[model samples]
Target: MPPAHPFDDDKLREECGVFGVVGVADAASFVALGLHALQHRGQEAGGIVTHDAETGFNQARRIGLVRDNFTSPEMMARLPGPIGIGHVRYSTTGSKGQTAIRDVQPFFGEFAMGGAAIAHNGNITNALQLRRELIERGSIFQSSSDSECIIHLMARSMGRNIPDRMEEALRKVEGAFSIVAMTRTKLLGCRDPLGVRPLVLGKIGDGWALASETCALDIIGAEFVREVKPGEMVVITAEKGVESHFPFRPNRSRFCIFEHVYFSRPDSILGGRSVYETRENIGRELAKEAPVEADLVCPVPDSGTPAAIGYALESGIPYAMGIIRNQYMGRTFIEPTEQIRNMGVRLKLNVNRALIKGKRVILVDDSVVRGTTSRKIKEMILDAGAAEVHFRIASPPTAWPCFYGVDTPQREKLLAATMSEEEMREHLEVDSLKFISLDGLYRAVGEAQGRDDNAPAYCDACFSGEYPVAPSDMMEQGFQAKTAAE
Candidate 1:
């Protein structure tokens, strides 16, 4: 059996994070540092692939944290090269077991033209359909991962160069993707047309870096250059520097808004805005939309802290640490069984009885998916002798499942899919519950006038049920979209 997850299982999980660097000495070490910074994006497995002129290619793929797997000098010494790419993976499409290691990436493939290794972030919605077609046409796959489809597609492409073949391969795939790939002579990066996931460009010494977030670049002292534009491919080579190409038709960018609310590290910048600042703005907006009288404002801890600070500032309520998190616990939601999940909250967090007793408390959290966590936390606060509890959710109710890389539960499993705000309040036994408005979220992200109904600035499909990309494989598998409630 898989290890029991005793963390916040109700939360949505990001699929993976990708990083690549060219022209750096001991490039695998730099890639490892970058992956360590992005460890929050994934925790199950990590891998790095490097290419040297004399040694050709070297790879290290392990099923654990970057620090645990890649920190050894012996391991780093084995992967010596001047060009490398790495990935931190949390499986979204493949099985979870010892066999799953086969899917752990920086998946390397040898082509007629040359050899390339690819690490990908985000989901390919049409992957199943494409995989079936490819298999029927005589493609032998190494793993069940959706990302492997890219390699198969590249093998069949008629384009001359690796970059050209990559562009051709991407044209046949659908949904969100931000890919980092490495060849003997080049490191390449690209984002999908919709830009559903993030990919940033950075510089360190004479080397160039491509990473899922700026925080990864910061870890190795890489100066942020800019984001790789949606639908654009960049190839970085020592002799030619960086060459850019637009492989897909240009489309209006639809960056995932959840990155600001929960996915990214607070210190990272996305789309010219600080993720921490956007979250704080969300709290301020929540305060305006739903003002509540309370003796203390307390965050759920970690993910909820910044928004809670902003909430207290806006509402003039005292901010206090009513709940304490155990520093050693990995996120509890990753546990596989119900028994472990039931014990997750207690293992990860505890109520501060001294602080919460006799206080009318307001709890600020990033989002509520299944309501399981909210219910458990409310019980904990009440048991600690809190007079009353109110919930201030930073994001709107997540009613729809995300098909673009985020691992959200089925529609029926989503609490908001069936319950209204009042209904959820009653379900959680909280004094009240209020989620930030959809337009309020847009404003918090810096769209001051609110979401443009005609052309919304960001993707809010989970709240609005207005999917920008058609989830083709899901539709074929009999999944239907749910309508948003008033």
Candidate 2:
């Protein structure tokens, strides 16, 4: 197997983004707008699906950002409908299996029972088992994503209505998920029992909306209502205002802690906690746990920049932009080779030698999945004449694969996974290094919740060894063998 860059050093990728609407005049357009609001979640691809009684269903999907793919002109030309669903996908399973337009969401399928399309957030832990079982029974597969596994399960179930099949499918699949789907006449939203991912419901006049983040609701003038609870499923239709059901009884409401630490947008709120506050807490905690003497606190780039601000404020040290990232560059920029990307880093970020020269700087970053990018950044800082660089990480080590949605690689490739903090510090060749204690992590996010404990039972398994669900064979096929070599 080749080396897999599942958890590259640049940034840990979020799994997917989902948006759905009902009773809107320009349903496809509104979904496009909503997906645009969530463009930060996933940049690999964007798609939309709409349905009207008069024209049936129509869809537009492409490989790019929502803004680039679903423009106003494109949205206007799309067949108008009253109900719709949209998805922005990032790869959890990067095998070529689901990278195509057909494999991308919103995934469509027609069965003898009926037909439906699903746009999903989060990874299915048991997807491989389910896919194998379905395959043995002659269930054909279109995409490699575990998200497609649910569609097949729902289609094959002996249920008359879409909701019935959905319920049956939900019962069979295990792990973290926040799924939004649409049938000919209805729009639906469902969260996994543990709610490892965030999902919310909102309203705009007579219309209703569902999105992975509240920021999306604000984008299209929707009132932020409330979060969809774990173990709950919601169905919205023309006849009913909003119907709710809990196929799975209450389990621990373990929303992913990383969402607060890194994944979600700063403006978005997840599980009643503000992402900005969570990041601030990490900064404050990093200050308390690993105080350092430095002329300036510098963030690696965008994600770490916020935490760096917090750390600067708490430590009473001024924050400076040591490295500047190129906002124009897309993740899939046409760099055909790693050496090209390595050269592109200078294009990606440049050091302001004026600020760092002759100064002992404290460098803050979200996490170090692999040692490559961090090493380059450190050398860049040193070359810019920083007297010393002290590295502070906001989260604990990412030593395990996330069975949920995040695409962390197998344990071995992660520097912190196999090496001690001191060993990793040597690997990166920084002057000194420190990571926020696991207890400190929970303390930061937990403080915002008004709870004394560090982390509310969210999925911290990426930082800690505890996993919400074991990695499925699908995850094994997608990441393990590839990650081992990297």
Which stretches of model 2 miss by more than 4 angstroms? 1-9, 72-75, 94-98, 111-114, 331-334, 337-339, 447-456, 472-486
How would you encode candidate 1's per-residue C-alpha lDDT over 64-86 as one tens digit per residue?
78988999999999999999999
Using Cα atoms with residue i matched to residue i, what is each candidate's TM-score against the true structure?
0.96, 0.92
lDDT of 2: 0.82
Decoy 2 TM-score against native? 0.92
- Once fitted onto the true fold, the runs of candidate 1 whose alpha carbons sit more than 4 angstroms away are 1-5, 97-99, 331-342, 482-486
Best by lDDT: 1
Candidate 1 clash pair list = 5-335, 5-336, 6-332, 7-332, 7-333, 8-333
Whole-model lDDT per candidate: 0.91, 0.82
Best by TM-score: 1
lDDT of 1 at 185: 86
